[model samples]
Target: MALPTLDDPFYYLANFHTVLDWLGSRYADLLSAEERDFIAAFEALPRASRALLVRMVMRKGVDFRASRLRYAEIGDTRAAAAPLIAAGWVETDAELELAALFTLATKGELAADLAPWLAELGLSRSAGKAAWCAALAAESPAPRALPAWLPSLDDTHYRLTVDALGERFRLMFFGNLRQQWSEFVLADLGIYRFESVSLAASSRAFSRRDELEAYHHLHRCRERFDADEPLADLLAEIPREPFDNPWLERRRGRLLYKFAYRSERQGELRQALALYHDSAAPEARLRRIRVLERLARFDEAWALARCAENAPVSAAETQALGRIVPRLRRKLGLPRGAAAAPAEPERIMLTLPRSGWVEGAVAAHLSRDQAPVIYVENTLINALFGLLCWEAIFAPLPGAFFHPFHSGPADLFDEDFHARRQALFAACLAALERGDYADIVRRRFRDKHGIQSPFVAWGALDERTLALALTCIPARHLRLWFERLLGDIRANRAGMPDLIQFWPDEARYRMIEVKGPGDRLQDNQKRWLAFCAEHAMPVSVCYVSWDEGGDERERQDAQGDEGQPQGAVIEDAGAPPNSAAGGNPA
Candidate 1:
C-alpha cells in the first residue's frame, strides 16, 4: 500500500484514521464502548477538528497553548477546537498545577503575571524559574485554569482530554507503547522499510479486552516505577499472580525483576530476595541466590545454587552458577570438587604504532595476498545465521506477527522461541547437512535484500564478504555456531571474535579476538573462546601494545601496515589448528 505523502496537510490525520480503521475492523470484538463511541464521534467531527486533535496527539504533551496551535490547514484554532471541546476531547478549562503552569508559561511571563503574589511572598524578580516555582510550591496553591492563574495573561491552554485513549489506540496498532505515531511517518519517509507479512483477520495484538487492560495496567506500573515511585507502593500494586498471557507474564516478570534489583541496590536484601522469588524472570534465580548470600543465609543460597546448577535456564546462568556454587560449597565446609581447566586459545602479541581502530589495524597486519582479513565483530556469523533461518525467524505463527512493521517475530526472545519454530529451524538447518546451505543463503540474501531483520547487518555484510565467508567457512562450523545460537539466542548471538582471516584457496578460516592494552575479556567473550576451543575451531586472541618510542616508524608502518613486521605468537595454549591469526565466519 502506498503511504500518504507529507505534501498532504492531512497526512497525520490519514495515518491516525488508518489506525482507527484497522482497529474498528480487526478489533471490533475487543473494543470497549468508550472506544467504539470515540471512533464514531471522531469520524463525525469536522476534518479540521480531527486534524487538530491528531496534531496534539502526535506532539509531546497534552497541554497545548492555543496561540501555538497554528496550522494553515486548520484555520481559526478556536473554530477547529470547538467541536473537540464539546466532545470533551479538548479541554479549555483544565486545571493546571504550579509545575504544569511553569512548563507552559515563560519565566518572564510568569514573573509578570505572578508579580503581585511574588511581592506578597517577598520573592524578587531576580529569582530564576526554579526559585519562583519553589517559592510558589511552598504556598500550596490550588490547581486552576491557566487564565484564572494568570488573569492578566491573554493566552488560553487546551488540554487533550483523550490523550490516554489515543495512547491505547497506538498500543493496539503497534502492539507496544515504545513505538509511537512517528512509526507511520518514518515508514512513509522511507527511513524504515518492513517486510510485508500477511496478517490474518485474527492477527491483532490483544485477543481480549482484559488482556488489553492488563497490558495497560502493566504499562502504568512501569511508568510509575520509572518515575521513581516508592518501591513498596509499586510492589503492592503489581499483581502477584502471573498473567495467563505469556507476553504479559514476561513483562510482569521483568518489571518484578527490576524492582528486586532496585531493592537490592537500596540494601533491602530481604525485600529483594522476596521479589526475586516471586518473579518468573530467567535470571531471578541467580539473583535470589546472590541476595541470599548477601543476607548471610548460606544454606539457602547453597541449596538454590545446587538446584539451579542441576537445571540451568541458560548458558549465562550456568556460567554464573559455576562460580557461585563453588563459593557457597566452600562456605558450607563442603570438600572442593576438582574441575579441569578450560583450554586457553592461542595468543598473538603485537607492538604496533597506535593507529585508528585497533581491530582495523590488526586486520591490516593479518591480511595476506591469498588470505584477506575482515573485521566482523558479531555481524558476519549472525548475518549468515539470519539468512539461513530467515523463514523460520519470520514464520507467521499466531502471536508471532501481528503487524506489518515487525522486523522479526515478537517472541524472538521468549523461552519457547526456538521450541515453537523447532520444525521450521530443523528444516533450515538441514540445508547445512545436505550441503545446499550456501545456495539457500545466497537466495535469501538476494531475495530479502534491504528488508529489516533482527540479525542481518545489511550495511556490513557486502557481497564480497559474503562470498569469501561462504567459500572459506566450512558447513560443519556454521552448523555448530547456528546450533549454539539456537540454544540461547539472547545470550549467544553476540561475543563473536572481532576479525576473521580467510584463505579461500585452502577453504579455511580463523576468527581472531583483538584486545588493546589493559582490556580484558568479557564473560561473553570468554564463553565464545571456550566454545571455539571445545570444537577445536581455529581461533586466537590478539593482544596489542602501542610502541610509544617508535612513533616515526609506526607512522611509516601505518601507511602500509600489511608490509610491516608481523606480531609475535606469545602463547599457543589451545588444541590443534592453533594458528595465531584467522578470519571471521560470515
Candidate 2:
C-alpha cells in the first residue's frame, strides 16, 4: 500500500476534514455564507477524496509535483494529485520550475538546500540570490474577486477591525513583506507559522536568523542618538518597521527634545519652538516659554508662565523661576516691591551655644499648649513653597537644570521662568485665604515632588500644623519676603530660620534664625531677614554662645557684614563676676 502524491485525488479526499475544521473554527469569519455553502458540498465527498482536499488546503498553494512527493510519511506510494486537480484547488506541474525554485529561494527555502543540491541544477550562490529576488519581484498571486456574501470591512477601519487570529496570521505571512523571506521569520509562537518549518533546510533557517539579527542591529543603532548625532537617516528608518514595542516612541520624543533644545540654543527660536511643540515634558514648556520671551512674544510667554505657576515643580525650578520672575516683572513695568509696607521696627537677635541648641531654646520659649513648634528651615520652606509654586519650579523650563550636565549654556535668564515664578508666588499667597492650602499641601506631599523636610512629612502635617502654617505668616508679607529670597533659591533655601513658633490662638508665627557668637549671617540669610523686617513678617535672629566661664550672654542683631555683628546688644541674664570687658564675640 502507498500514499498518493499531492496531485492525486486521494490526497485531497484524505485531508479534507482537517482543512474544513480549520476554516470552520479559526477562519470562520473570513468565509462568506455562499462560500461556506460551497465548501459544505465537500462533506458529501467520499472520505478518501476529502482527506486529499484537506492536505492540499493545508499546503496553501495551487501547484505541486508527484516527483517532489516521491517519499511519503505514512508509507503511501506517490501518485498524481488527482482529487485536488479535479477540485480546482491545486494544479499538477510536470516538475519544479525555475520561477517556483526562485520563489522558494526568496522565501528562505532554496538557500539552505542549494549548497547540497545546487550541483544538480548547476547554479552559483550569487546567481541564486539574484534569481530569487527577480522571481520575488515578478511573482504576484492572481487575485480572485471576493464573494458577494462576504462581510465588507471599511477600508479606514481595516487595521482596527482585524480579528486577533487574522491579525497574527497576517503578520506571520506578510511580516517580511518587501524584504527577503530569509530576512524575517515568524518565531513568536507560530502565529505566522502557516508554512512548515521543515520545508526550508536548517541552514536556511540560520540565514533567516542572521537577517533578523541584522534588523535588531538597526534597532540598537537608533538608541544611541543624542543632540549631536546625525538623525535624518535614523528618523526616517524608525517608522519603517512596524515594531510593536512602546518604548520606541519615547525614544523618538527624547531625540526630538534634544534637537529642539539645540535649535533653541542656536538662536533659531522659531525652529526650536516648533520642534519642542511635540514634547509634552514641563521642560519643553519652559523652553517654549523662554523662546517666546526671547522673540519678544511677551504675552505668549506670560500666558504659558501662568499655566506653569500651578503645575508641580521641584526646589531648583522654584528658585530658577524666582530669579526669572522679577526680571520679567521689570520688563513688563511692574513694581518689584509693594508700596512701602511698614514692618516691625524693633529687631531682636539671640546668641546660642551651638546649632542644635537653637531649636530647643526657641521651642521652650515659644511653645504653648495650643501652639506647637517644629524645627524646619530650608527643607520645609522649600517643600511648602515648592508645593505652592511647583508649577513654576518644575515646568521643565529649557536649559534651567540637567543631570550629568550636558555641553552648552542653560539659558536660564529668560523672563518667562521668572515671570511664572512670580505668578506662582502670587497664587500661593492667594491660596492661603481661600482655604485650599491643605489640599495643595496634601497633593504635594502625595506627589513627593520636592518634599525633603522631615517636619513637613505627610504624617507630620497634622491638622494643627497645616492650620498654623497657613495662617502663621501674613500672606502679603510672606509673598514679599519669599520674592526677595527667590533671587537664589539654592543659597537662600537653607538659610531660613531654624524654628517656626506659631501661636494658634493669635494666628501668628515667627521665623527665627539662630547664630552663635563668632558666627555671622550669610548673604542669602541677611537678604531674607531684611525682607522679613521690610514686609512686617515676624522674623528673628538668635546668636548663641556656650556658658563657658559661667558667662551671661546678651542678644545682638546678626545683620552687619558677613563676619561682623551690627545693632545694639541687650542684656537679658545676670552678668558673671570678673568678666573681661569689650571683647568682640567673634
Best TM-score among the predictions, by candidate number:
1
lDDT of 1 by residue, 1-586 (tens): 3568988989999988888988987899988899999999999999999999999999988998998999999999989999999999988868999999999999888977799899999989988889889999999999999988888789889999898999999899889998888888888887787888778978988899899988999999999999999998888888899899889999999999999999999999998998998899999999999999998999999888889978999888888887888898888999997766886777777776677789998888667777789999999999999999998999999898887689888889998999999999999999998999999999999998888999998999999899999998999899999999999889898999999888887788888999998899998999999899788888889888876766566556556556345432223324333243343321
- lDDT score for candidate 1 against the true structure: 0.87
Best by lDDT: 1
Whole-model lDDT values for every prediction: 0.87, 0.47
lDDT for model 2, please: 0.47
Candidate 2, residues 223-313, lDDT tens digits: the string is: 5554345544554444333233223334345556776787777777887787677654346777777788899887777677666666634
Off by over 4 Å in 1: 106-142, 148-153, 368-370, 550-586
Model 2: CA > 4 A from native: 1-366, 396-416, 420-435, 447-464, 485-491, 549-586
Alpha-carbon TM-score of each model against the true structure: 0.90, 0.32
